[model samples]
Target chain A: MTSQTKAEQTGAAGWTRRRFIITLGAASAAAAGLTALPGGAAWSAEDAKTVEEEIKRLMGGKELADGAKIISMDLPQIAENGNTVPLEVSVESPMTEADHVTTVHIVADGNPRPGVASFHFSPLSGRAQASTRMRLAKTQNVIAIAEMSDGKAYMTKAEVKVTIGGCGG
Target chain B: MAKPKPRIRAPKKASKGEVIEIKTLISHPMESGQRKDRKTGEIIPRKIINAFTCTYNGQEVFKADFHPAISANPYMSFFVKVKESGEFEFTWVDDDGTTYSKKSKLTVN
Candidate 1:
């Protein structure tokens, strides 16, 4: 028997199998839409926190110094692919027990989430240098802040032009 | 999702007080929860390795807190000063409470 006839024969309370399937699909779709609406709103709320705010949150009102001389950030001037952009950050420090880098926080300005990664280093690290790969949502400035164990912080930023966004754009 | 495989590169032997580079990479999707399915238009939930740590002989050497901005197949390289002969333990923690670890021994001259 044809599926249409089967569905008609199986009808109960004026609800055909075809109508039930369609209603089920619609209900799921509505449920998905409902979930996505709140999720998207939450993401935007997160994105509203700019890079500066993020840095301030991380620094906890500490004074941020210009790190042009001490912190070296190596990134591409223009990223052809935002999926994987190479980044290298090194801070000039003695790596001694008395003076060393405690953490290096990375933030991107234009991404949905500004917080990227934070690298914590100890004296055993020998050097406050690290390299990693990150995703860029668009053309924006990537900032690096190095917090020293001596209650000092250094900040530096670099701009990267991206041809294509990586955050599922 | 497939199981994430952790990979590490470290020198088996090093001179005392010598600074050595350690590289680590792990296979993961790093879903940012920002993407939507093309057909279903449903949002994909985020799942990523949120933390990585390296310890030498029970001493913390290096650690990193990751976010969704980290790309797929997370890769990181850092420096460590080898003071004594000991084993290095590396751990990667996922968002789902899964932890992947690897150990390597380094002999310091």
Candidate 2:
């Protein structure tokens, strides 16, 4: 009985060691492919841009005014699914040639990438309103920034609790 | 993969200078390049619709730039003011330099 138990224990240990080696080999192979593949460079480059960097790239150092009165966002307080979270943004603006919302940018703080979408509007867009669905990696804040034709920007943010992460899938 | 299909919804008739809502959806995987293949454990390269535009009678009305964070099968809704009966052209540009477009006519009364 003692011999049999020892043999079983050794078999289990050997199985674990084999799994560890296989995992290490796979990880190294993936790392090598990430650098050696043709499109891999671009993929890593895109992954390097953080949320703050992306936001700066969009805003270009412009002052963001408080949008509490002008901008309104409709988003779920708790998203059951992070893969598809509904988002709606609207700005109080009279769609006119002289004064209108030129662009509305959506950015998620906890997404793999910050930028969600940027909507460009014109006077023909009678209302400064838009709705779309986005993916959230985790529980994070969703920010909406509206750039007006008059060269001013309005910004607002809301937090959304996510039950499951969307990026891993 | 099947060809990405474009779908749009807009009112067929509207009063002059009336505001109307338009919704558009396109079928695309929007592969974020972050997910790994279950069997191969290999990362899937990203391929998504990057830009969408709506033009009324040749004048650009609404445009959007999309990133990977956009869900698969992108859907967008916006507003437009109709001044006259004309065709609204909706275009979706993919990351692979392919453009898919659809047109819808609106009659202004």
Candidate 3:
């Protein structure tokens, strides 16, 4: 109205620009939210304890005795890859019906789920041993618990240091 | 759909009452459902081998339950006590309801 053509033209275009900026901001915010979810939840120390507690509860809340010699866990001291780590567990026992290893529970305390896998054995198995590859979310303890037919439980723990790719921050 | 190929390495011969080892590996990507597509930025649905079982002479010898944290090309090894000549069957169940299986024969002398 006062011969201010340039200012008036800019004011009209500024509204559209503001809306565009707002839309872009919202889109980025949504992407951020998605990234914050699911896999982003790192395995924290508290989570490790929770995993141990859950395993204990599954074991009837009874503490597992340290199996210094009976149980052997074969895993690398330093895992170069966090995604694929080979593990082996062997229990020295006579595969007899009277005295045999019943089950072995594998737990990676640092993974999202503590209990990785469980191996069951019968006298027909002749040996209590298993090998498998698993993903480790982070640096944590890998535990193996072997339950015998005589109602005795033994456990061993090994720490694996995960060295490569994790949540790409 | 192209089926997954399962491979097994087990000795064909063993002494009677001998403990033998069996190894198995399957071809699978094992998408953890926790990943996102790099280009589309979309979450990839989780798919994995959820379970594995081995039976000898129609009797269960070994079994395992797997989570998403298992490796891509899932590999497992277990021991078995061979009693006589029998067939060993290995089975793997995927998350998508696909079952991949293979068989091997063992002759215990």
Q: Mind giving the per-residue lDDT tens digits that candidate 1 earns over B1-109? A: 7899999999999999999999999999998876655555556678889999999999889999998889999999999999899999999999889999999999998
TM per prediction: 0.84, 0.84, 0.79
**Local distance difference test, each candidate:** 0.85, 0.85, 0.78
Model 2 ranges off by over 4 Å? A1-41, A44-48
lDDT of 3 at B23: 92
Residue runs of model 1 more than 4 Å from their true location after superposition: A1-48
Docking class of 1: medium
lDDT of 2 at B52: 98
Measured by TM-score, how close is model 3 to the native structure?
Answer: 0.79
Ranking by TM-score: 2, 1, 3
DockQ of 2: 0.42
Measured with DockQ on alpha carbons, how good is candidate 1? 0.49
Greater-DockQ candidate between 2 and 3:
2
**Candidate 2 falls in which docking quality class?**
acceptable
lDDT of 2 by residue, A59-83 (tens): 8778999997899999999999888
lDDT of 2 by residue, B24-105 (tens): 9999999887666656655668888999999999999999999888999999999999999999999999989999999999
Worst 10 residues of 3 chain B by lDDT: B34-43
Q: What is the lDDT of residue B7 in candidate 1?
A: 94
- Best DockQ goes to which candidate? 1
